[model samples]
Target chain A: MPKEVAIIGVGYAGFRALTPEVSYKELMYEAAVKAYEDAGVDPRRDIESFVTVAEDFTEGTSIFDEYVPDQLGAVLKPVHTISGEGLHGFIAAYLQVLTGAMDIVAVEAHSKASNILTPDEIMAFAMDPVYNRPLRANPHFIAGLEMNRYLCETGTTREQCALVVAKNKHNALYNPLAAYGASIAVEDVLESEMVSYPLSRLDMSPRADGAIVMVLAARERAEELSDIPIWIRGVGWCNDSFSLENRDWTNAIYAARAAEMAYRMAGIRTPWQELDFAEIDDTFSYKELQHMEALRLCRPGEAGLLVEDGATEIGGEFPVNPSGGSLGMGHLLDASGLARLLEVVLQLRGEAGQHQLSDVETGLAFGWRGLPTTSGAAVILSN
Target chain B: MALLEKVDKNIEARAWQGEIPIQSRYTCGLAGEKFFREIMENGRFAGTHCAECEYTYVPPTIYCERCFAKLDEWVEVGPEGTVQSFTVLLVAPDGTPLEEPDILALIQLDGADSVLVHRLGKVGLDELAIGMRVKAVFKPKKEREGSILDIVHFVPVNA
Candidate 1:
């Protein structure tokens, strides 16, 4: 049996399209201090181990792992970089906490996307250098292709996807931390600048700089530290091949397998029935729907209707992305996972005031590291 | 006044030119024995077939990622897939800069288990369709410098 892990405290330094005023280290330090205070523990003595989620290329810094410890208050503690998301980083941290390796783990993830003056140059680097690079294509091309396939397979339409941009951007209005809140209509989204076919500029998540940090401890350790402990009931992650030649663009095999493992372990036979709410990885509008189907929150190809029917609305049956998700929250890449995890804790604790669902006890969080966009993680949480 | 003119001319020169280095590493893997041998020979695309599972892999593999075991057979895949998903791009990666717009799409190859990523040509965003039939246009055998780009791009074949 996987050992139980609990979130003793969660902290967020609000996301932004560009936090030009603060240095990357400063952005992380602000969140780290809040996390320590929220957990009511000192990082110097309480944090037993640290796990950081980051990617080398995204940061434009090769040894990103080396530079994080100082800002996170781990001068010489055991730290491991998962090179992905806070959930994936926390997955490893949970193991450390449960295996009696460590009592407290500080998990952190952040992005400095705005620092890259040429966003296109950064995106172009994500392509497969040999075969993919020569094509001279924007990363949005992949989003467009996936969107087209998602529509064709699900019997959904472009207008429906436009609604996702409208709904989420509108949903951001209530979220103080959200960076892209605007009162926009479906027609407005459809009319926006086209980045790729079946996708518009508004359909995409903005590249932004932000940070999220959460402190987790063993179940017993969590109870000792805080009155409210959001137990991590299940954690599972899987990776598909990196090369585009191998991936199935229509669906996420990694998500399907990871969700199954986490759900089964959490004693959740039917995610749609058992899961109270989910903060899915919606780097693009379609991913939320794709991950919904993969999570089995809805039957295959049924997510489009789920969105169209208002089932995923903030007040709906299965409220999704009440924090406005990546579509509303900035896509801080690796930090995106922890952002979802943070929102889950907020909702379960009745702290998410504007987008709170009705008495949510069982919540699910998922993360996908967008490297040729193949890796994903699913964690089941309950208070 | 003289210094201002010199500085203004320098700013224009700085604005127009500079080469920035962009590097990335891709440690992609190949599966299966025949596929492994093809990589050792350093040329071409290979596929794996499973009669029991009835799935074929385009870039070849030692075992089925589905069933997880060793497989022996190999075959040639694409130079084609009917266009499954496509997008036209206004920019290319650092290594291969393009002055003209380019089209890239996922091709569900004729006899492969999954779609392969490739470039599409002679196509505009307006002309591209979901189910368009296209053929792989290979970089000449002499120019076939061993990569997924061996086939430069997929073009609309005369159906």
Candidate 2:
């Protein structure tokens, strides 16, 4: 039998599109203090190990894991870097507890995107040197091509994509830390300057600075630690084909596989009605639509209609990304996944005040990574 | 061959020795790793032609990791090929907008199974197409060597 793991504490520090006033270390410390308080445990005492999700390219610093210790107060402790996003880090931490390796482990992911001077150069460098890099194409051009292909395959309109932007940004208006929340309209998104053909300025998530942390504990430690423990019922992560040219641009195969693995592990046969609420990453307006189809929240191409029907609103059948997702919250790379997981934990604990939904027990969180890798992680959190 | 000769910087008077950074990275597979030595030496471009898989690559890579077979036969990629894709970059990674556009293109070196990314020479976005054929124009013969920059660019074939 596998040992169970539960989140005993969670903390967040930023949703700022640009954080210029404070040093990056101070930004992380702010969240660390909150996480330690919520976990009701000290890093130097109760926490057994630390795991951080970070990448060298995002921060423009190599071997970035070295800088994590000073900020989080994890001095002289076992620390590991997952080199991916938050949920990937979350899975690594979850397995640590499940394998009986340690009692209490903390996972954190953060981003300081606003500080970076050249975001596209970093992404372009990620391409295959021989074939892709020579094109000098902005990464968003791929999003444009893929979006065009998606519209062709799914018969969805640019209007639907615009609606996703409008709805998510509107949802963020209620969130205090939401960076991109505004009274945007479908026409506004459609009329936005075309960054890549068919993909407007509103299509992509704005880069932002933020930190999110979660403390996971073994079942016994969790039960003793807190009255409200959100047990991680299932954790799954997977990757699809790497070559973007060969891939079917319309579908998120990796997300579907990830969702299936998590659903099976959690014994969830029908996710649509069974899962209470979800926090899916909407890095781009169309991504949410594609991922919703991939997660089987609605059938492929039905997400546009689902959004229009008001079925995914806060009070509807499935309230998605009540904290506003990457659209409102801003794109913090590895931190975005953890933010979704944090929302699930908060909603399950009845701590999500304004965006709170009724009778929420089970919550799902999804994350999609770049490199056109079709990489994603799904976690089921329940009280 | 002598990059420093063109710059005409008087190194004798400088307090610190001049430095021209040439740091670049390469992706190495079985074939690519073995091929790098050949590329770094002579100015010739070569690739493996596997009997079993019939796979050919320019700037020869080694054993086919895909087919799991040792490939020894070499094939030369021609000086001309067709463009698979092209882009005009207007912004740098740090969100700095460029003053002028740079054309980057993927060229399928003739006789190779795959394409190599390189700079395109003297072309406008409006004049280019996905299949427009082009040929490699090398640096002056005195400068030709194993480096990727041995060939200045793949200029339009008809141009």
Candidate 3:
């Protein structure tokens, strides 16, 4: 078996609908400072590698990695970028630690989503230029169609999907970092103006600006470095078909395959029974249920019933997304997965203040690359 | 930390907004060249067949995604297909509400194992259903440009 890796420290800055005051670089620096301080490590001296997750189109700049080093305290150091979700970056850092190439590595991801003006256009640009982009349709249409298919095939209702919005946003009320916390009912989600058929504006996670940095170390160093280290029990990522036509619309096969790989690594055969909670992707209301099934937290079509029964609430059995998730915290673009992992870490350390669950030992964090892509990553963490 | 010190309340951060000018032309690859040519010249659809997988890919590619077979077999699919899934768009890419909603569907072209995403035409949002048969409506021959758009839209065929 490979050497174990543990998240020794985590820090975040900002989780708001807007952050006009801080530039993206400032966001990274703030999170980096907090992370380094929490880990009690001087980046220039202790950390051996750094990874930042970002995309050129999302950042409105080419070679986005060129801008990361300075803010991350990685200047003149070995640093790299992963044009993938934040958890993918975390997984990369984890693998680096496992390889014995680095004892301590830092993973950084942030969403200056507030900085994006043409958000939908940027998403559209990610489509097949020859086949799909020419249609000039808003990219969320893909999510809409997927939601439609998922609901139809699984017998999950639109109201059941709306309940996810209500549950997550309601849970966010306890999270100080959450931006879109609300006490709205399912009707509010149902009544929200439709952006695409069966997908309402409220059902989608609004954008937020935030940064998160995590320090991971080999097990020995992890034990020596921190009082509360969350062990990375398993990490897995997978990419399904890039062609939308070839994908399983009803199922997040990417998430399922990623979870299977992760569960195998963690020696977890029954995720719903083995894990205490999950902070999976909920970029859209229906996605929460779809991911729930994909993660095998519950049987297919049963996720909707679980939400309706409040079994996934913060105090409920096997509570999921107690940190408010993207729905409550606002989607942080590529950084969304890191935000999810941050919550699991905080909760594992008994540091999640208001929304903390009782007697929780293990948690899961999953991320989807979002529309026009079938890539996903999953990580299992235990204290 | 020195770089992130709080600026005075009155200080306006100096920043400029600008757009980068970029231009490029995309080459429809080996498979796309054949696929689009068939649409433009013959007003038909073609897919590459992978004998090993016994699967046909619409909007064909040179290599099979499943078994990594070099696909040299070309098969005609459909000008007619069944709607696999669909959505009605209420907003444009720019977030502006469209004057009239547009419907888009993933059509499983007959004879091909894969689907193609295209616009749905002559159908109301209330009337569209999954598994509904639809036929391609192509633009005039002279206007055909060897593009996916050569097929104007897919309209519902007789039940």
For this target, which candidate reaches the highest TM-score against the unseen true structure?
3
Please write out the lDDT profile of model 2 over residues A306-371, one tens digit for every residue: 888878877778888888888887888778888889888988999888777889999999998864
- Give per-residue CA lDDT, model 1, range B1-159, as digits (tens): 001122234234322223458555655554533443453354445788876788887756667777886867877766556888777654344423346666777887788876777778877667788889888666656665455556667788863
Give the per-residue lDDT digits (tens) of candidate 3, residues A176-220. 999999999888989999999889999999999999999999999
Measured by TM-score, how close is model 3 to the native structure? 0.98
Model 3 C-alpha RMSD to native: 1.4
lDDT of model 2 at position B115? 66
Higher-ranked by TM-score: 1 or 2:
1
Off by over 4 Å in 1: A1-3, B1-53, B61-64, B67-72, B78-80, B90-101, B123-127, B139-150
- Which structure among the candidates has the greatest DockQ? 3
Encode model 2's per-residue lDDT on B1-159: one tens digit a residue. 001122134443223223223357665566555554444454445788877877675655556644768778987776788876665545444555656665655577888765666668878767866678998876666664435665678889887
TM-score of chain A of each: 0.96, 0.97, 0.99
Q: What is the per-residue lDDT of model 1 for residues A109-144, given as tens digits with 9 covering 90 to 100?
A: 998886665566666677766557665566667777
Best by lDDT: 3
Better candidate number, 1 or 3, judged by DockQ? 3
Classified by CAPRI criteria, candidate 2 counts as incorrect
TM-score for each predicted model, relative to the true structure: 0.87, 0.78, 0.98
